[model samples]
Target: MAQGAALGCLTIASLVVARWGGPAVLGEYALLRVLPWLTGVIASAGLPVASTFFLAARTGSDPRLRPTLLTLALAGSAVGLLAWAVAVPLLHRLFFPDLSPGLLLLAGLTVATQLFTVWGKACCQGQADMLGANIVIVGEELLFLPAYWLVSHAGLHGITAVVVAMVGGGAAATALSVGRLAATGFFTGRAAPSLRLAREVVVFGARAQLGNLLWLVNLRLDFLILDALAGPAVLGIYAVASKFAELMRLPATAANYVLYPRFARAERVDTDAEVRRLLPRALALTALATPVLALAATIALPLLYGQAFRGAVLPACVLLVGLAVEGASAVASAYLWGIGRPGANSFAMGLGVVVTVALDLVLIPHHGAMGAAASSSAAYLATSAVLVGLTYRFSSTGRVSTVVASRAEPL
Candidate 1:
């Protein structure tokens, strides 16, 4: 609930953008986000997932683990910033030629800030510290409005202001996350950076990120295609619809943020039962929430995002089908990653991407936003089916027991 409300605050920034800039400007702003967000994920080297895994599995055994992970996160952020410096020029030329290079370059700050922020939160969750994790999550997003308010008053507006506000929010989150992590005395003990541990983290992170990267792109690829074939105005309407549709995914976010580490910690005994136990609850939450949220949005979309955004309602309704399915998929993915079978998720997400591209190619030209919605729904269901099928297979075959946990590479 706190997380959901915090996201609501973040959405207020979008509302401001939509109201002031309309759909075209809004669409452009969304485009600005794709690169930094993608880069941030790349920069993490999957540390958030890996942190939760290693931290939870060895909760009290290793004091050095927290500090070691912290050191690596700092180093990774530096590398990410350097990489962003190199790539932003080319990326701006290719993908965002219509937008300003200066704005894109400025948004690079988010890559480093967001990486450290997420790593800290993931580290907190590693110890089953839900209160601390939730505090960090809520604290970060809740500050978005105040930061935007301050920056807007200081003569920053439009996408530039939003970008700056995002950096501010990220910085705030970094302070909160790192501060909370420190409260646990992460830096008080003697620690050294272990290359062996670093290699293991990178490898695990790479494997875990395969599906994650695919999933992230799957969420955003349609926006690019829609923008190309249609216009920014059309993409903006679609973006509003996408945001509303994703509200149903709060359950998935909860599972990913909280349950993933638990799965990692308990994988030695049984992941199948956890899957069976949580899958139904998460799926049911989506089923119940989608229609209610859709109904609410029908009345609220125009009032909140303005009448220009009324067109988003139909598309949002269409997207609910796939999002409901994605709820199940998220839990299944957590199970796969937690149990070190991330290849299963990679295979599923890869298949979903193919479906997404093929459908976007065929549908967007004809149907526009509705086409994107349909494509997203079909692709989501495709990924969900595969994940659920794999979990069931493992359940029946006792394959999970074969995954012998090693002391060094626990998974």
Candidate 2:
């Protein structure tokens, strides 16, 4: 519930920004986000998933692992900062030529703060503190909306205000997350993390990181592709449409927050019955919600964004189809990761990225925003099919064995 409300607020906040600043500003904000978000995902090195899996498994026996995981994440953030420095100039020249050095520096800060936020949320998730985890997830947008509104009202418009608001919100959220962890005694006690455990985490994190990086690429690479081929104006329109499409994902996001921990614990017991039971209902709900959301968005988008964004309607609807497929796929992917099959998950995402890139290259130049939408939706459908098949194959044999054992037992 908290996660849903927070995500809803985020959607509203984004709409507010769009209404206040229009397409160019919204497009620039979306473009500026690409590098930092991508860099932060890379910098985290899959520690979020690694931490959740390892920590959930070990939290009962090794409380000290929290600080160790955090220490490793902090080191990863420093490395991520260095990466941002190298990537920023190239990214700026290619996508954000008008951005000033100061704005770029602020973008770097966003990446650093986001790393901290990711680490903190990972810790809460590892501990199975759902409330704390949701807070961390939602905190930034809560802060960002108010800051954005204040700045815009105070006559600061365009990318400058958006970047400042982003940085401020990120800093605030990171602090709150860290504070929540400290308050819960995550950083307390004298027992230190072991070298063996550290090595295990690093090894797991490396594998998980690759999968995560690929997954992010599948999600965000479209922005860059669109910007290069269609320019900012078209990209901005598509970005707005994409945001509405993303709302279709809220149910899946909420489900995964609770499901990942449950899946992790279930993996320990070698039982997937719980996951199997819950997945269909989650997917059904998401499937049912998508068209309703599409209807609402069709009506609301024009009102919220004005007629300048009327073109976003069809694209948003198309992307919602993909998001709906992605909702179910997300649950399956989480199950795969929880069961320590990130390699398989990565392969699925890689296949999807290939599909997306192939289609985007052919389609974006000719069809523009609609082509981008079609490419993303097709890729999502293909990837979802692969993941669903992989997940069922992996879990079905165990399920059959369990069923046979139960049937054969004396009753």
Candidate 3:
């Protein structure tokens, strides 16, 4: 709840900044805000999933895996930095053709912030410490809202301030989390006992990371395609539409956070039952929530983005349906990962990405944001179907376990 409120506050703050700073500034803000997500994903190196599973499995029990967790964090950070370096030139050419020199510096700073912050959060998640992670998130929101508010007053440079706050807060959280881990001897310089464990961890982490990358692209593909083919003005409308659609998931945010650990733990034991019980509940909730939120979005966007955005209503509605499919897919994905089959999950997401891109290519040049939504809706629905089928086939084979039987209850 606090997390959701914090996000709401940040959204409000950004909107205010947009109102004050004007649409052009808002466009810049949006770009700055969205671009770093790609870098953040690379920086975390899928440790969030691995660490959660690793820590939950050990927690009060095993002390040996601590070093491994620490090792992975460091490794993931390094990978993120490397990825940022590789991506900067390409992104600069694509998004900011006349990129300022200092912009690169700001991007570096943002990447640094994201790497440390996510590393810490992953560690806490591994330990099943959602409270600690949420505290860090709250801190980020508390800091960022005020920082953005003040930075908006500074004109163009204020955007830099927004970026800095993100990095600084993340760095602070990561440092604190890692410090605590070290104090607990979790990061002691110890030799990895077996090459097999390291290989398994890396393979799992990489596959999960790939799936995450695909997800990142899939979620933002509509906007990117719109911006590329339709123009900045249309991209702006699509962004607002996407935001409205994303708001529908607000209710499930808490459940989403809690579900990861549950899935991870379930997969550790009877993976199949865990998925079978969880998938339907997630799907039902998403289906129930979609239309209500879509109606709300249709009503809200005109009010929020002003009359200029009235055209986005239908696109928002389309995206809302896509978000529902994504919600169901999200739950089923947990089951896939739970059962040590992240590769299948990755393939599912990869397929969605391919489909979305193809649809965008075929439809966006002529149809604009509406076409993008169509692509997203079609692709995500297919992805959800694939994920559910794979999860059930893989995880629902054994005799009805107690946990599995209990999960038959619908939402």
Best candidate, lDDT-wise? Answer: 1
State model 2's lDDT.
Answer: 0.76
RMSD after CA superposition, every candidate: 2.0, 4.7, 5.0
Q: Indicate whether candidate 1 or candidate 2 has the larger lDDT.
A: 1
Candidate-wise lDDT, in order: 0.79, 0.76, 0.65
Model 2, span 267-349: residue lDDT tens = 43354666566667767887888889889888988888789989999999998888787667878878776766677788888
Where is model 3 more than 4 Å wrong at Cα? Answer: 58-64, 154-161, 168-198, 251-253, 267-271, 398-411
lDDT of 3 at 269: 51
lDDT of 3 by residue, 32-99 (tens): 56666566556556666666655654232444456665666666666766777777777666664444
Off by over 4 Å in 1: 267-270, 407-411
Q: Indicate the residue-level lDDT of 137 in model 3.
A: 60
lDDT of 1 by residue, 131-161 (tens): 8888888877777678878888999877777
Query: Could you tell me the lDDT of residue 139 within candidate 3?
Result: 58
> Using Cα atoms with residue i matched to residue i, what is each candidate's TM-score against the true structure?
0.93, 0.92, 0.84
Residue pairs in collision within model 2: none
Query: What is the lDDT for 142 in model 1?
Result: 77
Between prediction 1 and prediction 2, the one with superior TM-score is: 1
Worst 10 residues of 2 by lDDT: 402-411
